[model samples]
Target: MAKSFQNFSILTSIVTLSVLMFSQGMLDTAHAEEYDFVAGIHNEVTFHFRNGIETVNFPVFSTTSDIVSNIGSSFEVEGVVGNNPYLHKALDEAYLYRMSTLSGGNSFEYNYRYFDVDVNIVQNENVLKSFKYDNCEISGYSVSTLTDDYESYLASDTGFAIVNNIQFRCGGVGINLDSDKSSLNSESRSFTDYGPLPFKLAEDVRTFLTFEFDHGSEKIESVIFTLTSGFSEANDAGPSFQIITAVLPHPLIDNAIDKSQKVSGMASTFNEDFDVSVEFTNSQETLRGLDFQDCIVSGYDILTLRDKEEGYTGKRGFATAEILDVTCSGLAPVNPAFDKLSDAKESRSSQMSNTYTTNSYNMGTGPHVIATFDFDSGTEVVDFPEFYQGNMIARANPTFTLVGVPGSTPLLYHVVDNTQGSGPKSTGVSSNVELFDVNLVLAYGNDVVRGFDYTKCRVVDYIVRTEHDADESFYKGFALTDEFYFECQGYEPFNPKYDELFETSHAKTESSSSWKEKQRDAWGPGFR
Candidate 1:
């Protein structure tokens, strides 16, 4: 069997304004506004080799040239148009232009120009070799124009790809001879010259092959896998079997497939004895799911959980010490004065008298006269006595005198009931009769004469009289005719007594005799 030969290669290059800094006579441009760069593979190809024959699976030289042109135009338009204005300005000012190309065989180059200055970047190739069975190969590559554009290109196309070839050669196929004196020419009868022949030798085998470039072109910024080979049965069964799972960090394979049979329900089942089950409780401690035990009640007081006394079910929980009944003494007795007046006791005589009277008398006929007199009744002299008693006898139309009568004299008097017909009543006059019933003698002599007609009396001695009586008598002698008359005499002197006395006695009197002297001592004068 013929050997299978598969080759793959990848390349990448990145350029930036920093590269222009190293060029001679390439002064950094400060404010160039716009710039352009190109990034595309110049030639990329993939071939399948069988028996030393190569068939182009993906040919970039002729068929894929449009793809390269489109890529280059895309980079020039997108990278330049979207770049920072200052960076574009610097590039344009420096006349900076860059180009990058990548081929299928991990071949790449970066060419930069700033005016007359030029720079080249390259990445060396990474190759894999095998000699056991037919060799199979695959490769990936990429190329970047500007540093910024490189990132964009990788993000878009990721990386490059190279096709693989499958081929076989029969073992033990040596020189052969034909019959009938015809000889088979070894050179003339090539491998294809005869019909299909089969031969076998070693065990079935497989391997991975890749070609990568590291041409020292601004370093290999990153290597990414854009394509990968398919999986095989051997990969599923191998101890370290790997399948292409992810791409960014080169490639990845998970152990899930390699260890699938070791899972539950499979022949090489996973260990069920090692499995554990857990349960969560409302307590601080944990217990195994299969175990049962009483939990320790944290933060619970045992004393609070038990009754205070045995069989004491009054309160289910705890209680403090019982408080004995308390009694207090030493309170002072309240005064009866402060107590509310009861209905029975409240009827007692009032402490403050309500009726008020003055000593002055009225002279006008129909006017009221409050006559006041002092009396010597053999006990103490009553200054302003509350009651007076007397019996009065009529001496019709009698006249009396008022002068020089001492106020101490007593006389018999009566309150005549003027409301009756013509004469005194049989029941006699009561002491409580009105004062007008007693005809007050304006003045009186020594005569004991009395009656409502005392308006006539004149006597040898002056006299004044008021009514008085004994406790049981209907009428009694009150004071001497002297006392009442004396009061009357005093009042008659000042007929309009109230006003005249008040002015004379209450006025601010002056010691001076003459009218001039009195006027001189008036309020505004020097005497003031």
Candidate 2:
């Protein structure tokens, strides 16, 4: 963007006249008969900061260009029309108005031409209402022209009037609608006078009170006007001071594929109220058919893009929401393996000497084997061991003793020469053992296919063993086995059907324990 001080000559002329009038005591006093409050047609807007001031104005003959001041707010003025360049500048220019004070002290090199100014509404040569707009910026700017209209343009009113048409994002608006002259806030308040003056304009005051707010289709409640006018400080009526306000556009969601998911009532800033899930729901609509029923909002990003395109005059800046992922959901599948499994599988293949290919897949293979066993002990567990099947059994005692061989050669034996039996063996009655519920689950891969519930089982003894034999039919010679000797507390032991343990108390106990362990492992050891 180029800076054009094209109005320097005009400003010098105005200052020269101002100094002359001051010397003649014409600018010293308020409420004087010679004082004039009418505004000039060729007006200039000046931005006064703590360090210095920068001023801008339209060409003397240009009528197509205009300045819009939102009192207690900002100024959006079209820049000088030219083929050279435009003020489609950076967001830093417009965002400077975000400050509490209207002045941004020389921090930027390019003046996007935004500032606060006071406006005096004058009627019948008398001031009626006063308004003030604070920190401001050129919110928008555009340049456009068509060839067919050149004939009409040549016949029209002016030339070089198509340049600096820029909108503004401004800060607070303060107004003094004081009709009574009893207070200092009367319309006659000091204003920084600019341009050649009959001291005023012949146009109706309402004609100068135009402001286009960026809110979507909402009704406007107030009218703020900004200008380079105020009571003269030399007149003992120093430039009138008024409060200002920032009017930001309503937050919007654009370019969304799913319009139904775009919800309203999201806050634009942290100061506003917001719901995390609601925002997430709306943000997810940026892409179609993308829904996360079990997702959470980890953080948010707000992008404020400045409007720099021609023929686009709605909002000066737009805010877009960006989503971030966070693992805050506490839902787990029915089986632990299910959490570790993926929908797709990875595989590799190998070819043997016979040209038979073997493909190994990453997916879990289904359970292919089930084993059954039976055992008996004398004490209520079972009737007896399988005596008829040639199984070796160890009795309570044996008289003959044998010693092992040394270096795989020979064995030694000690023979009992005498035996004594005093009397008949005494028999004792067996007592019943208490039974508690137990559940046994059968699974294939990550899926639980069946479960068994023993409602009245007192486990006497259980053994788990792996045996190996060279003559086994299977590829691997090793076999895993589990044996359980359980006694029923009731009169008769009935086998419960499979899948009957789905809602059993024992199942629930195990599930709860597993859940607790999973939570601790996921978060921390302190988690319960």
Candidate 3:
């Protein structure tokens, strides 16, 4: 029998352990589903007065005058619990108080009554906070007749009910009053209760409150406000109010204020745009190492009737086939050389005749039979009218004679007639021909030549040549030729003369000679 009982006992113990484990698991799940409610670390203490009359208004009080000055002087009533303990703690730390006033009157009224109340414990300065209430039943009964009231209330009880009802309903009742003599003319009321009231307290109230730091005037580390409440006999339980205080780091509040002002002033002084300029002391030396890229400009403008009538209005008006003049100047001199040729050559020939007959050739003719011999003679002319024909003369040696001064390699010049024509022609051949002038002038380094700047250089003249049919009857067989000439003068010469007087005189004479020759060719009697 003993061995059988031992086996049953071991089995029962195993079942009990299993049940306990299951119960613990279920409890953990229940706890995980619960919501979080926290209370504020900083809270305010508030007092509410109550009278037995139901229709009368309850009085209100605050511990500190600063509370009324900051957030307004009005007080609101709310119904809650667990908030008073946090508020009481904050008031005691801050040492502030206030006196209650009667509604619509400047005088103060005092009233007392036993009332059931609720209080709210707030976590932060924010009004919203988690709260819990005390479980108790309180009825309106005179304290003078506790046992009589208890017996009368429990007359309808079943068993041991009267004693239980009185203990539960009238067990917890308390009063609170302000003892500060500075604000009151009379002594304040005191609370009398069995031990401490069975009020609910928050387990974790610190999580709900937040601290705000003011870095400017106060240089405080944090600011906190607490809210609490109480109940009056005339009204139902209501919500509590708040008291605020600032916690500073040190005594250097003035330095923080000054720093804040300086920062603001500096922000206002900032500008979006600033200009900077640097001037060189030695321009030539400073610019010696600098390099500039070449640039080209080409365009055309016209002066219309209105523009001309306006007399230099600096505006371009209507234009009729405006001619664009592109001149490249200020270029350093380059070696004069030929680059390439365009047209191909073709051999051409024409015949000419000159006749001379001998008088005695038929004198000895016999039997009245006179035999005459006819002689034919022809001459060949290699006619090349094309721009780059082999028979055309190439300008290999150009002479630049400037008086007594020896000349350098002359600049290469070419005039292309872009205008439509039978073949290549020179500007010298026709006055109405449209041509583009190409010149190889000097340029320093690798910079290509570009548009003309009068302050830097100038162009004097251009020479060209053209060829055409000499005779209208055999236009394709014979060739007529034309030639061009040019001269220019500008700036100081690259080569300086050993004798200045001789150089000047020689230059003057050469200039006159070239000018007179050009004029003679242009309008002389030979042209006419």
> On a 0 to 1 TM-score scale, where does candidate 3 land against the true structure?
0.13
Two-way TM-score contest, 1 vs 2, winner: 2
- The local distance difference test score of each candidate is 0.19, 0.26, 0.21
> Model 2: runs farther than 4 Å from truth?
1-44, 54-75, 79-115, 120-128, 143-148, 153-160, 178-528
Clash count, candidate 3: 31
The window of 10 residues in a row where model 2 has the poorest summed lDDT is 410-419
| lDDT value for model 3 | 0.21
* TM-score ranking from best candidate downward: 2, 3, 1
Query: Between the candidate structures 2 and 3, which one is better when assessed by TM-score?
Result: 2
Model 1 error, position 46 (Å): 99
Give the better candidate number (2 or 3) by lDDT: 2
RMSD of 2: 36.3
Pick by lDDT: which candidate is best? 2
Candidate 3 Cα RMSD after full superposition onto the native fold (Å): 46.8
